[model samples]
Target: MSSSLLRRLSVGLAALTGLLGTSLIGIRAADAVTVPILVADVDSGKVIYAQAPTDPWYPASITKLMTTYVALDLVRQGKVSLDSMITISAAAAAEPPSKMGFKPGTQLTLDNALKIIMVKSANDIAYAIGENLGGSIDTFAAMMNETAVRIGMRDSHWYNPNGLPDPRQWTSARDMAVLARALIRDFPDSHDLFSISAIQFGRAVMPNHNGLLGRYPGTDGMKTGFICSGGFNVVATATRNGRRIVTIVMGQPSPRERDVKTADLFDYAFGQSAGWTSPTLEALPASALPAPPDMRPFVCGGKKPPAIEDGPGALSAPGSAAQLIGGSAANSPALALAAFSNPALRARSLPPRAPLQPIAVWIGRNPAEGQQILESQEAEQKAAAANTRAAKLEAAKAKRLAALEAAKQAREARAERAQAAREAAKEAAKTTAKPAPKLAAKAGRPLPHAASAYTAVETPSMPEAKPGKGLSKPAAKATAHKPAPAKAAPAKESTGKSAAKKPAAKKAAAEE
Candidate 1:
């Protein structure tokens, strides 16, 4: 063979190799862009289609469904009532955009809060609810986790009540399917909160983030979520012919992709019948799921054209399936009504959402009757406490009065005893003051007795008195004579001594 022929063949083979390499690169790029998707029967919990359904992915605002679920549970348990007002703290008000921008101290009833959250996907409102019902965000998160476990959401963990971009806030499509089913089954009364197309707050009317509500046929209710890391996610529900279905699409490249994909999943599920044999959501294996992919760079900083733009008022008619089911050029009610005129779309479009008669909420206004109820409770407590204190004081006063009465009786008894002792002492003193009777003479000197002295005086008076003298006069005279004789005897003794002294004086003189 000629060398030139060999060179020509080599060049052709090189061109073929280059083309094959380019085609393989394109195929790899397409395959690498997989996302989590799942569709299930709302009533039976059976999976209709699954694509990496157990792979972990950031839940984004879809976490609010769990937040809503926990809130509804608390409401059912009477821990929080629909009319209960939740105050907005600074932390809750400070959350990033896609929020209500309510100032700290804003107050909203549980019912109003849920409506705003569902319609606006307001981050601040979600935070406020978690803080209010859980008493703190952390506690609310615990409740979310407990409820998730109870409902068999095995591959989900919650870091915040609002599905903010936390590295740890992850969930799987299968787990979300479990949650969506649980929300419908457990709290049927709250089902209306999710289907509301728009809510009016003061002068502002905020439409729901779930685009399917007004556009997709049979789209009844559910929620949507997004963060940079988890491009855009949606957990949507639709009903047809009395059969309900749930579809979950996570980590889509754009909101349009998420919505379109969800619509496709719903279409596929509704078209099936009883002969399908896919496993139920619970029967699917959930082990060894992949870690959530970080789409932050692609979502936030990419220069490439978006696969689908989800700008406001940019709702062009989607693919044939969407057109067949009443796809509209824009997400307006008028467009939705116009699109519904097609016979093919009429049976699929959800009935017009009921006008929202939202419970009143405010940023700084008084909480109305809720505050009054709280104040009344406090006042009653204070009054009860005061009554208890007064009762205690009255009891103490009664006890003191009894003590004083007993003391008074003791003093009176002591006084009586002292008086009796004094009387006895006086009697003893009188007895002792009486002179002892003179004992009969037992010694040489006779004791002077009143009777002996009377007898002696009487005998002396008898000798001198006449026989006929009266005894009374004789006794008086005798008493006077006894004293006179005693005095005369002393005088006579002195006179005799003087006589003897004179004789002795004369004899002494002769002797000298």
Candidate 2:
């Protein structure tokens, strides 16, 4: 009786287990998030582990990798030296935060700009780098795309230098690995540029955004990026013994998660046999997705997915450790997932970072020179302002003087006109006065012929003439009108005898 019942129970349990397993697989397939990951050997370019590596995704601030690349390339071309000064323009300054907040016209060497971007991930500085290097953001972006193609990045299109949000700008995990490898192989001297612990710009000290920089062993340098649309992203590099590896992680929900996930992958990658047969970054085929899937909904949506015991790539990479160890489908895409990810290890906090080694970056060629140039510029501006003010004052003063001069001239003219009028009026009063005959009558006497002489010389219809001092001839004429008791009367009385009688009278008077 016990055997029959036990067999029946066993059969029932087997059917139920198969059904549940199938349902779980379907749920995973439908609900799993798309996280593009890639791990590659720095020198060989052989991909040790990759997951959706070729699927397009937003690069976020990680776009600065291309920016730094373009700038360094220009330096390599000998077009611009590291010491060449670049300016923070208005457009660059206008960019939103994660910035240096330097004012427009602030000047700094390209070297400083590169350092600030790597450590601070400053959007403004990155934009300035693009503008300065490429003559504009668009041209720099063109350079980025060109270089992407040249570097064998098959799935990337860059529209901006700083990986700010733009639908047109996207890169695949495989492409990012290709870029990272290019940056390393192309410019070995710039190794410190990516892994700087912190940058001291004036008084402010900005730490690098890459959490793994100091927390993880053998971590050297690289980059990290994020936007709501593109979750926390990173292109990281680490060197152990003599080998370096590049790991690209995209679409993590938070900084903690990104760091944890990346650390997990690094562990899994380092554990795998380095010589195992694997696809190269270029060998990984591209995803057929037409567009980059937007991560904002899942990342920034009001409700985050509930935390589970396993982290990213946990479910997808099942039992592949045993398979990979035996070299079954080793070249095929499989999870680099650790054989078992203990909850303690996955959730463990990273160790405290080492003391920051901050590099001093300054404006212009040197701090002193930059200060001097700024001072000189400021002085020149002040002088110009003073000159402008002086010019305005001079113009106003000239205008006031001109008005006064005009007023003075007008007053002088008026005075002259008034004096002339007064003179004319006095003359007119004399001319229009009562005739001289009335003056004689008023004097109780008559001046013989005076009225006729005065009337003959002056007329009411004529403008009066001044009593000029040099009018002696006209005065004599006036006096000539005085009657001499009739000279002709005396002549008639004495008759012809006057001449002889007058002579005799004069001789007799002389004798007496």
Candidate 3:
């Protein structure tokens, strides 16, 4: 490795952040990162240069290389034709971004789908091709594995048709290089599919993710993929001096780093003497890494989701390697003279890209048919949006109704508790109550009737008859029955016989 690369890789990320200052905002660390690099000729399977080429690593979007191979193979087998219409299934439409956004029922030709996936890397388009060709993703993945094994891939497994962050899906640098060779060798007619700089669908233009497509000289065709888990990866090819070289790079910290390193390796391989002897891609020793590294922390701080770029300007067609990408390859050095003993092979800067030539990619059989599909998709999207709105409104109304029902239940519960309390009080009264103490019958008198026993009226609190302070017991007893009737008798407080005597005495006194 050039010392410039070593210097960049060796310095701690915290220190690099201090160097670029604000310019380093989105820079990622490739430090201690396992990178798999391979450069081999297209005609001969011999590798000119390699490092950890057989290590297990997440393939990211390069899985599309296999996707393209399978689609082309099916076309070759006459099982399907490129012009056949593929109905976008619901599963296809539901995939995450980097997609064509075609509705579930919308239809497009397989030819158009392949083009879109090659340049746009549309996850949805790749998936639709899989479903239409192989019946489903599971079946399609089996097809991918079968094709991989047939093509001499030793350390690769695939799950999804679009390589969207699948832990189960992985491919090594050698495997990718081998797959790229198969793509170039088997389908010579479809070479343009990989070199499209940009694809124009309707008015929107999407550039290919492969950085070297237009910037690097004689660079023909390839693919690039990124997910936080897998970092940045590419399977690229460049033809110079009647020689075409396929390069595979995996697990670089950023797209710029991946591109620069690939370009550097290309420079090195192109300069190497013809006697360079190295193992064929298939014969390289396997890496001890049992599984692909989770690169989220090093590449994206382990937080950002897949398919997001550091900036909006990336993935442009034939544009300057702007900033770290298309602008000057300033971030990647010319490999300062001291970094390299061989003065000729230092990493070179990428020039501002030639103006982008946006290749027109449309849907359906022709531009007119593609227009109809686009209009239909728009209508369906509107309907889907309206349905989504209606669902949200219904959900809100249901939530309100549920709350009202809960309140009603709470009120009923309180009323039930109150009724239960009243019932309980009545039962307690019955349980604790004793029949009014039976009035003790005095001498021989019959006990008073229940109603008369506790009357509402009460007796006078003071005595009616007055006695001398010191009267003999016999005298008091004699006077108890025959009290003297004073001339001014106090009016009786009761209406029984006591008040009648008071009235009679008053009347007698008046006559007198």
Q: Pick the winner on TM-score between candidates 1 and 2.
A: 2
lDDT of 3 at 153: 94
The TM-score values for the models, in the order shown, are 0.56, 0.61, 0.62
The sequence of per-residue lDDT tens digits that candidate 1 reaches over residues 20-106 is 222233232222333567878888887877766887777878888999999898888888788788788999988776788776876
Whole-model Cα lDDT per candidate?
0.67, 0.70, 0.70
The parts of candidate 1 lying over 4 Å away from their true place are 1-33, 274-276, 303-512
Sorted by TM-score, highest first, which candidate order results?
Answer: 3, 2, 1
lDDT of candidate 3 over 1-512, digit per residue (tens): 99865554444332222222322222332222235678888888888877667767777678888999999999999989989898888988988778877778878888888888888888888889889888888999999999999999989999988888666778899999989999999999999998999888899988888888788898998898877656678889999889999988776655665676677767666765335466677678876666665555445542444445321112211111111211112222222111212222233346666667888877778899888878987898899999999999999999999999999999999999999999999999999998786433444343334523222222222234367544245543344335222221222322344434556545533543
Task: Tell me which of candidates 1 and 3 scores higher on lDDT.
Answer: 3
Clashing pairs in 3: 320-326, 320-327, 320-353, 321-325, 321-326, 321-327, 322-326, 322-327
Error of 2 at 24 (Å): 8.0
Name model 3 segments beyond 4 Å from true: 1-33, 274-276, 302-349, 376-512
